[model samples]
Target chain A: PAPDSAAQGLALARNGQLTKPPGALGRLEDLAIWLAGWQGREKPQASAPQVVIFAANHGIAARGVSAFPPQVTAQMVANFRHGGAAINQLSRTFGASLGVHALDLDQPTADFTQGPAMTEAEVVSALATGWNAVDPEADLLVTGEMGIGNTTSAAAIAAALLGGNAQDWVGRGTGVDDHGLARKAETVRAGLVAHADALHDPLEVLRRLGGREIAAMTGAIARARMERVAVVLDGFICCAAALVLQRLHEGALDHCIAGHVSAEAGHGRLLAALGKDPLLALGLRLGEGSGAALALGVVQGAIACHSGMATFAEAGVSGA
Target chain B: PAPDSAAQGLALARNGQLTKPPGALGRLEDLAIWLAGWQGREKPQASAPQVVIFAANHGIAARGVSAFPPQVTAQMVANFRHGGAAINQLSRTFGASLGVHALDLDQPTADFTQGPAMTEAEVVSALATGWNAVDPEADLLVTGEMGIGNTTSAAAIAAALLGGNAQDWVGRGTGVDDHGLARKAETVRAGLVAHADALHDPLEVLRRLGGREIAAMTGAIARARMERVAVVLDGFICCAAALVLQRLHEGALDHCIAGHVSAEAGHGRLLAALGKDPLLALGLRLGEGSGAALALGVVQGAIACHSGMATFAEAGVSGA
Candidate 1:
């Protein structure tokens, strides 16, 4: 669907709901109603909201963009398995099923070693692997990426795909200081220059500098389109994946909803290019689907308002 | 606690968690961690989050600051009983038990009459009623008010408590137009003049113009202080009640957690007087404990992080 057509659906959902007057439900109500129209139903239902965690090692970690060592990636994955990560807590809270996929981007299989980011083919395959892991019947999919120093990867990808200086879109990831950020920015710039021609293609750029997790998220978004599953994006990193998918298929964006805006610099540019608004702004920079998880309640509130709120006719109240 | 004291607790919660590094959980994680310390427990628990709704008639409703007629106050109360209002939906979704109480201020409780704005005796009675309504032991209590033309009442209370201009604090409640707003402002000014002597005695002022609900909420906040329960505040209106409680018992401020900052102009003054910072700012003006309901999850998240997240000691992760 083009932007106009998708917006029309949103408008219809906003108007025809059986609840309170138009826009009474606020933004969440708007989303639920929009999703209802997208699903072509009056009572849009979400049984299982799936959160896909894409994990890959970033080569830029060597540039000291992150306070923790790159080994934290694999370690966090193990932690995820043990259900100790933030995402794990959010998954339980939101009742969203969590799927953790490791993108073996030629880094250490069990520890950490630096290498070129996953090849383009590897990126696509890793995404496919994660996307395939989802039950196609899942009501909605929220994509989150987990990779040490991946902020550097995201900045490079955004610069190449959206056309900008890498330094502007980049920010301190994992609490790196000013000097560390400078080095990280320089490293990202070099990666962009080295892969400029390949950067002409979003997939090519992702493969060149994006970690396995990002590629996996791109694949997940693509698969979501194929399966007609709506994708709720978490912060700047995941939006990078959505941008790649938008290039592949403009209609793919119809399935995307930005959960919240990040303090990260590039997120605004990506959101603008995609022509979408981030629903919440709490100055969150942490990834791992925490923002997306918070947005789930908003979405749920929307659904409840649309499905449960009494209209003027039903509640016998006057409407403006 | 001072800002730095709260910040220290946040720093602890941000760090020493098993999954992510310090600041990895973002602002929410820091908040949750801070709340745990307030509870005096490493892991805080929130089994029952309570929202007490106070319904009263405002003297300003006579001035016409609202699109809806004042009769809508009792109508909304009926709607609430039937569980058809937005607040009803929110309390249900957030799993926070809700209590609605009517404070009688010598106004006609007759079928057509709006309500009793409190009298000092009525204020004391309403607070007593509200105090008795809650569990002797509860984790958190949220105080919210519902009334037509309540923003005018709130602005007046804020002005009286904080010594600000009523016009400066007043806003368009329920969508009043410019002419209606001017009338509303005039109404606030007239009410201020009419009640100046009574307002000089805060309790007397509350009895004169504060609706039964505002009086009840003030009592509930005072009760929360006595019971040592955390009180989550919504917006300007709620903050006005909080200010009264703060005036009545200075320690009452300790139990409050500013839930969300309102787009309401007076909220800034009210929050400043209370010496609190709101956790979220979503441009919300819907006053049915909607802001507090949203904050419920954050409070729960804070308690959960303290209780559930594995410490570095437990997970055997290296400290920074």
Candidate 2:
């Protein structure tokens, strides 16, 4: 479904009469109008916002690309279940409903350097997990991921779709040292070379060079668009997943806003390619939907001001 | 009272052992530790945050330095009183206590282009209004302003304290035109020249070239510091107020963090001078503490993550 132009028009009209100078609210004004258009309401609200976290083990972890071992993915999933991760805290802070899904944690995706990271059937299952995870009642959605060696996969996907070398897209994930960073870049290069033929199709890129968690994010975002849930995309790996959808369909991410550009090396370039100006930029590099979860507060604030503020006539304030 | 070094040390130690990589949260980590230091708790929270808005009328508006008429200041104060303003909505969104102090809005200050903006006694009254408005129970504080043509006064104060010409500080405030901007620069230059001898003293400069609202912000910030409440200073006008305190006493703003750098031309330079790094930079120029109120969400999220996340040992997650 397309955005409601009528609702957007009304929102713009209301924004002008809110008593402050025109455009004084800056990007917040845009955020409110965008939400209004997507929610198809002149006064849209994300009263039931949702955040989903996908966890999967990556076979690429064997290549020494990440600082932490892959087993930490499962451990952190348990932490999330215990309400003990950063995302869990953030979800509570912003009143977001939290869900975590682990896709075959015991069966790691195949290393992309050797072949496709996942078979077609396996990729389909991962996509279904994400698609099924979104709540119909949710007015806003945020997706995050947990996989130690996923940065290598994300870098591969970005480079494959966006015409960048391994160096341009690679960065230290999970605090990898300089030597480990070189190893990650080399792994990205190998993965891209191994799947050069399959890379033309975006879904193939997801299966060949992306992890289950990444694939899940891609599917969840698509589901949000279908559900008319305005989405706030997370940091680097999350944006890489979104880029896959972007290449696959025009306006696939029209419902989405980049929550924040991560400190990751490729994120700024990726956001530029996607033409997204992020909401927050505190140099955060942590994933698990933390950035987007944090950004939910900003969106809610924008919506509240748009919906709850008084017009010049209502307040009896003189306007320009 | 000084920040508790012991609390900050404990916070730093706790941050090191959190589930994510070291410093993955970037400036948020600094925010949390800073909060802990001021709140004197290893796991501090801003459960009772307060936002104070100081509204006043500036005589400088008569010079055509602002796009809006002088009456807009009093009208906006009424708008705030009726809860129709942006700050009201933001306070409700973030669970902050909102206080609006219109410091004699019917009494426009003397135009600094010809003479001092306020008498010493008048400045003291405004400061006391701000100082008394702060809730002692507030764990976090944000101060903002509303005054047509206050930007001219703010620019004049920044120029006086930080050594810059009018051109370096002047910008389009409330959608000023090219001619209005030129007029603003001229007003600031005239104000600076009119009070050149008293410019060496920060408080004297505040009385001579600053508004009651600006003085009130300076008082509120000082009050927050005395109460050991962490402060998030707002845009150019707010920063200029904090700068008076910064110049009057060394490390006066150590308890403060810049909320956001406004789109105003002098704000980035002001932040640079204060040696403060802003939390958000969304190009927001709204002065009703909107930027600081929005940033309260960011600060709250950072504290939630810092205080609530399990340590690696507790989560049983492997660490680097």
| Winning candidate number (lDDT) | 2
Off by over 4 Å in 2: none
Candidate 1's C-alpha runs over 4 A off are A1-24, A105-116, A247-251, A263-265, A318-320, B1-15, B104-117, B198-200, B247-251, B316-320
Q: Interface root mean square deviation of every model, in Å? A: 2.5, 1.0
Relative to the real complex, the DockQ score for model 2 comes to 0.83
TM-score of every model? 0.89, 0.98
Q: What digit string (tens of lDDT, one per residue) describes model 2 on residues B209-248?
A: 9999999999999998899988998999999999999999
Candidate 1 residue A313 Cα shift, in angstroms, is 3.1
Q: How many residue pairs clash in each candidate?
A: 7, 0
Looking at candidate 2, what is the lDDT of residue B152?
89
Per-residue error at B151 for model 1, in Å?
1.7
Tens-digit lDDT string for candidate 1 (A1-320): 32235544654654553333344344655576567755556656555789878787866676677877877777777777788777777767667899888777346221112334664466667767866866677777888877888887788778878887768878876677888888777877787767766777877767776767777787787777677677788888898877887777676788778887877777877888888887666667778877777777666655655556665556666543
Model 2 chain B lDDT-worst window of ten: B277-286
